[model samples]
Target: MTGRHAVPEAIPQESPAPAAAPAQEAAPGFSGRLTAPLLIGSLLNPLNTTMISTALVAIGHHFGIGAADTAWLISVLYLASAVAQPVLGKLADVLGPRRVFLVGLVVVIASGLVGTVAPSFGWLLVSRLLLGIGTSAAYPAAMAVLRDESARIGRAAPRSVLARLSFAALGSAAVGPTLGGLLVMVVGWRGIFAVNVPVALVAFGAALLWIPADPPGRRAADGVAPRLGLDPLGIGLFTAALTVLVFFLLDLAHPMWWLLAPFAVLTAALVRWQLRRPDPFIDLRMLAGNAALSRTYLRHGVSYLLIYCVMYGYTQWLEEARGYSSGHTGLLMLPMSVAALVCSLLGARTKGIRGPLTLACVLLTVGAGVLMFLSGDTPLAVLLLAGACFGIPQGLIGTSNQAAVQAYAPARAIGSAAGLQRTAQYLGAITASSLIALAYGQSAGDHGLHLMAGVAAVLGVLLIVLTVTDRALRGRT
Candidate 1:
């Protein structure tokens, strides 16, 4: 029913060129470049999350405020993201992922313009929320485009290409901290965002020119484009439920016991509503029936949680306890990006071999080992090495896990599949970080390190569990 369903192949061939009209002149691998802009253009959205993190303390100082109060900039973005993913994803599939992606590009560009003139932290929060809204388009839209392109190729790509497509997209995350940090230093945090304006312009221009649109003559088997009739009511309920849930949990450190009751009530109501809907915003059945699929989603979610805890928490520690500058912190994170980038590319060669999963498991276990080894007095070299270890897994997790999910998900429901995938990514991050915060967040030094290691160790074990479950599930089928 979705635009992403498998299309019948035209003929047998060694390589299947993607389905689309050729432009005025063709270059080698033209379709690849045609698709590149989607992923490349989308990179800055997640990059914003990483780059702004190191600057939070500095920005707080600039605004004459405490870091605690200014934490909303980050939370608001996450809140926007958690709420935005389901709705924007549904709309992208129906209205056109390209159109939805452009909205994100525009939102980020406009936010940069506003941040250039922001008067206070409150104004910055307003800009960040808009930025979040725009970024919501990047991941789902990028993946959806790639999914469609793969289907259009009209021939099965031997799986490696699929892995390559995903990891390559994820590999862009490696560029985030490195690029964002350098920009923050050269032009300040606003400049970090302003960089998007040019990238968006180019991507917007390219999308209009190169990316193929669904042809006019072919009617969808469903009569209308599946996107035309997305369940708006389901979308509303889903977003409202998630936004409220994120808010309640995000404020948990305040010990808001008064909110606990109502939050629970609202969440329960949302689930019941979704269950009864003719077209639930997210299909719970797909997630429920598939163990491999479910494990992939759970691990994907948990992995990001671990990475954020490491990335943000370390950024805070380096500044508060060890006296590193924002520039230095970003610089230190570069090796991580490099490690992740390399593995993601290399992972393209390792599909279904257990190589990617096994390597990921090894890297995370070692990364956890190195994290536990870190200390306030530890030398910078050792800390950077620790990050590199973590980066290897961080880089592969998004792409590799996504590839696994898609490899196993039913073909017709790529949008919902991705929605489920993105959902786990958000859920993993929010739940894991929230727990880590509760355990040792108040303490600002080595004690936090020790406690965080315990959290990482537990997560590492969970990753192993995920690996086992995936293997067992694959075996059953």
Candidate 2:
């Protein structure tokens, strides 16, 4: 369970849906009780994801597994969610967000229940798969709903939407770790999942009443219902390619040598098929057509990779290595996450200025560099200082980059653009986790920090090159 804040400027580039449409017209803000329920319900998405993160040790203890194996319990959920999101966004566009949102809650509730009571590791993985699928449905649905809500409110929405979304996304991010820590400390890991089951039920019930349906488009008759005609062969091959690819990388030191050949072949095949298909799963058109948007996507990918490696690795290092309580580990991460949200709020204020892009590049570039420096055996005060400098700036830069991509995307492709952008993020997280694991393999302490520093340096150089070559961005603000 994990979530990140949505950047400001997440609007649909094209004419999304006319305001008259059911789903197109945003639901009115409720007066009292509905507001709190809806807000809390919407937040469950983030809460569920982030809760499991700090609870890994408890999970491992329950299953009697090692850290490496338990790590997959987290990583696999992200992998499945990333792969499923683009497809789910298309469903949201067609079937209507309200429908998808409800479905997502239902899936989440069931998965949470399963995880809460699961008897074995195999069942736990199965439950995680269900959770991933549910989560895939929520992000797009939430974005679409927010977009519609903004439409009803006119231009004032995006300004405030960041805070609202951030509160849900980043707020939940901050809360999840702490709450998860508390839950694990109390009843165990299952208690974390147990809590989610009730929350999901409430969200589902409220959504059924408060969320509205969409009017029909010719292409979207009956609300983007799942089709039997989906290309199973292509999807299977693609999923297999990603699976083998991840498995191979995650086991780099051990090297599943034979899996590499199949992984390569399947990846090539998936690429070829995607290129030929009229409706590709990867939405290469959105990715390839816009230079700014594409670069933003890449920037986001690199940034997430760097962020997750340090944040995730440091958590385990804090708890397992340093003997901090889960609560304290969560507490330690608070400053960075809070700094990130604060930076986002500040960045949102400066949107559309010419300097935003440059400011973003500078912030992330320097932040990445600083994080590299702090990754070593730095003193606590020095590390905290680094967190303030780096976390705040990167938070601002990350959302700015996201907003830029959405701002520049082609018409009618907002869903693809958003989904693709997020995919870049998840891909980075997944890659970073594997790479950092490989780097840290059996090393005593802080040895892997250098590998990440190398990554930060390389990304910083690339950002500089890209910023220079793109003349439109220079002094454009």
| Deviation (Å) of 173 in candidate 2 | 2.9
Please name the candidate that would achieve the greatest lDDT relative to the true structure.
Answer: 1
Flag clash pairs in model 2.
1-49, 1-50, 2-49, 23-214, 95-223, 95-224, 353-477, 354-476, 354-477, 355-477
The C-alpha local distance difference test score for the whole of candidate 2 amounts to 0.63
Candidate 2 lDDT, 1-477, residue by residue in tens: 001122333453323445566643454442233333346555665465557667776676667775566657666777787777776776776677778878887888888889888999877887888887886776677666654544444332344554465456545654566678778777877887788788778777776776655535513212343333334566777788888878987777798999989998998888787667666666454456556666777767876675566555555555665566777766666676677667666766764533654555565556556655543345776555544554564456555665666566653455557677767777776787676567665431455555655676577667657765765454432
Compared with the true structure, all predictions reach lDDT values of 0.65, 0.63
- For each candidate, how many residue pairs have backbone atoms clashing (under 3 Å)? 3, 10
What is the per-residue lDDT of model 1 for residues 1-477, given as tens digits with 9 covering 90 to 100?
Answer: 122223222111222344464541133332566666665666665666666767766676687665445456666777677667767777776666777787778787888777767877777888888887887787677655654554455333345444544664566566666666677677787775567677777777777777777433322323444535466676676666666666666555677676667667766776776667656666555556666666777777777777766666666667666777777888888898888888777655544524566567667777767777677789888889978977888766776666665566666565556666766766655654455455444434666766766778777887777776566334221
RMSD of 1: 4.5
Q: Which ten residues in a row have the lowest lDDT in candidate 2?
A: 1-10
Off by over 4 Å in 2: 1-50, 146-159, 216-234, 352-379, 386-390, 442-444, 449-472, 475-477
List pairs with backbone clashes in candidate 1. 94-227, 104-134, 301-428
